[model samples]
Target: MARIRANGVELEYETMGNPGDPAVLLIMGFAFQMTRWPEAFRRSLAEAGFHVIWFDNRDIGLSAEMGGLATYTLNDLAADAAGLLDALGIARAHIVGMSMGGMIAQLIALDHPRKVDKLVAMMTSSGAPNLPPPTQEALAALTAMPMQRTPEAIADIAVKAQHAIGSAPNLRNSAEVIRQNAIDDFRRSDRPFGVIRQFTAIQAQPRWHERLGSITRPTLVLHGADDPLVRPAAGEDIARRIPGARFKAFPGWGHDLADAMSETLANEITAFLKA
Candidate 1:
């Protein structure tokens, strides 16, 4: 792990594979740390001959926090991503983002086109008003306040949320694995307020469908067919708006990226970047 000054904040980041290799920058979703990009998944990408970069976005993980701030937007987040690349001396990289990260990735390709070689927007929407909203259960799980901040309590809530929006019954992880991940994540950082701030940023972001057309980079849109959080229609709409962009959907997948889906996700991502 290392720290770099980006977008007026210190960002925590890690890199895998040889620096000489092509770079793949992985951005996580709302309130999620870079660690959410699974180790095994990162390894697979590295083995595929790419340098994988993972980092904690501002206000999350060991990165700087925005205390007492009222609001921020996705453009600010996009700038941060660009700033990180600048700090690391990477001229350009394949930008891969999940959920909110996808929104930021879209903005990066629009705002900093030269810095993004290829784009992968996964399990996210274009933030258009016409896009379908998340299901009640998924929304509730996302917005529900935790009863306690204890590791176990947070873990329980996390597990419940995962079940509410994760892969179909047969493709989900064992309870033990989910519990462990929750505990680990909680221990790393439990700042619910920061998460709320990130949520605020997402809410404040403008719809990107109008701007997406300007993204001329090779683009790939990935989503779960049954994702309750960000519906499949959102993914389709994104692909439809971006010229020459390809869309891929997993039949039974959901908002959560469990171990069961890692191989398929990594393989598809590798092929897209290579092509």
Candidate 2:
């Protein structure tokens, strides 16, 4: 676990593959640790001849905390990512983000275009008004908090949430895998207040949907047809608003990355970046 000071905070990060290879920076979603990025997915990208980097966003995992402050916005989050590249001496990189991370990635492409080679937004939204809202089940699952901070309690909440927003039964990871992931995350860092702070930051961010048209980077918008959280139309809206952006939606997929979808997602992303 490498921790480096970037932007204004210390970020826990890890890198894979040769340093000489083209870089791919993976930004995870709201309140998710970098470990949530599957090892197989990271390894696949590295094996495909790219240097992959992922880190715990500020206020999550082993990264620096912001106390009770919710003053930061998505743009600040975007800067954190760019600063990470600077710390690593990377001039530019292929930026891939999931959910809220996608929103931040869009900002990077818009506000720091020189630092992004290509952009991939997955299972995320443009925060456009009147966009389809999450289903009741997904909404409840996402908003639910573990009553106790114990690993079992936290893992149970995560398991239930995954079941609600994850891929179809046949396409999802085994129950054990999901539960263990949650447990691991909890054990690594159980900062519920930090999670709340991150959520508040998202709520405080200014809407940037209309700004999507300004992005000029080669972009790919990937989503799941069954995604109930952000919804497929939200992803489509991003692709539609961004000139020349390509969109792809997978059937039987949902909000979370499952083992069954890893290969397809990796292949799609690798092809786009190489192109």
Candidate 3:
């Protein structure tokens, strides 16, 4: 584990495999830490012969949270990615992101094309700012009040969070793990409002539909057929907008990529890179 001053904020990052291998940077979704990428899964990617780097975004994990209300734009976040690459002495690397991370990836591909070797955008959207905004139910879940984890509340919170975000069909863990992780991660920092504001900023960005054509790199778009948070429609629209982008979605999958489909995700991503 290490902290690197990036794009103005200190970012926490961890790596797997040798630096001599091809580099693969994995960015997590909104308000999530890099731990969302499981060790075993990261190992698989590393074993596939790529150096894998996973890191915490601004307000998550051990990274510096320059106060939740300071505000940040997608351009700012993209610059952070670029700064990270610069700090690591990497000119370019395979970039993969989930959900909001995908949004950042899109911006990076558009603004810093020279810094990315390939792009894999999973479970994300263009956020045309106006078109098909997240379902009210989805928004509600994202903005819902956080419930403290008590012996009695664990099951309920787990169910609600799972219901709102769970799309994994092949998950091996029970409800306990989900509850524990959620509670722990949510409390890692003191600012849930920061997440909300970032979501709002994303919502307020100019529609990304128009510029998807400019992203010419080999790109892979993955979505869960069962994703409830950002519907699969977003993925479809993205694939259509980008030139020669391959799209895939799995059934019984939801917003959280950590669950059942991670293996398939790793497989598809690795295969696409090789192809």
For all predicted structures, in order, the TM-scores are 0.98, 0.98, 0.91
- Over 4 Å off, model 3: 129-133, 147-158, 168-173
Error of 1 at 261 (Å): 0.9
Candidate 3's displacement at residue 127, Å, is 2.0
**Per-residue lDDT of candidate 3, residues 1-71 (tens digit):** 99999877899898899999989989888867777787767888999999999898776678877575577
lDDT of 2 at 220: 99
Which stretches of model 1 miss by more than 4 angstroms?
A: none
Task: Rate residue 64 of model 1 by lDDT.
Answer: 85
TM-score of 2: 0.98
**Per-residue lDDT over 1-275 for candidate 1, one digit per residue giving the tens place of the 0 to 100 score:** 99999878799999999999999999889988888887778999999999999899888998888887657898999999999999999999999999999999999999999999999999999888988899999999888777778888887888889899888977777678888888998898877888989998988887778888878999999999999999999998889999999998999999987888888999999999999
Which ranking of candidates, highest TM-score first? 2, 1, 3
Q: What is the C-alpha lDDT of each candidate?
A: 0.90, 0.93, 0.79
Model 2 ranges off by over 4 Å: none
- Highest lDDT model number: 2
Q: Between prediction 1 and prediction 3, which has the larger lDDT?
A: 1
- Cand. 3 TM to true fold: 0.91
Which prediction has the highest TM-score against the true structure? 2
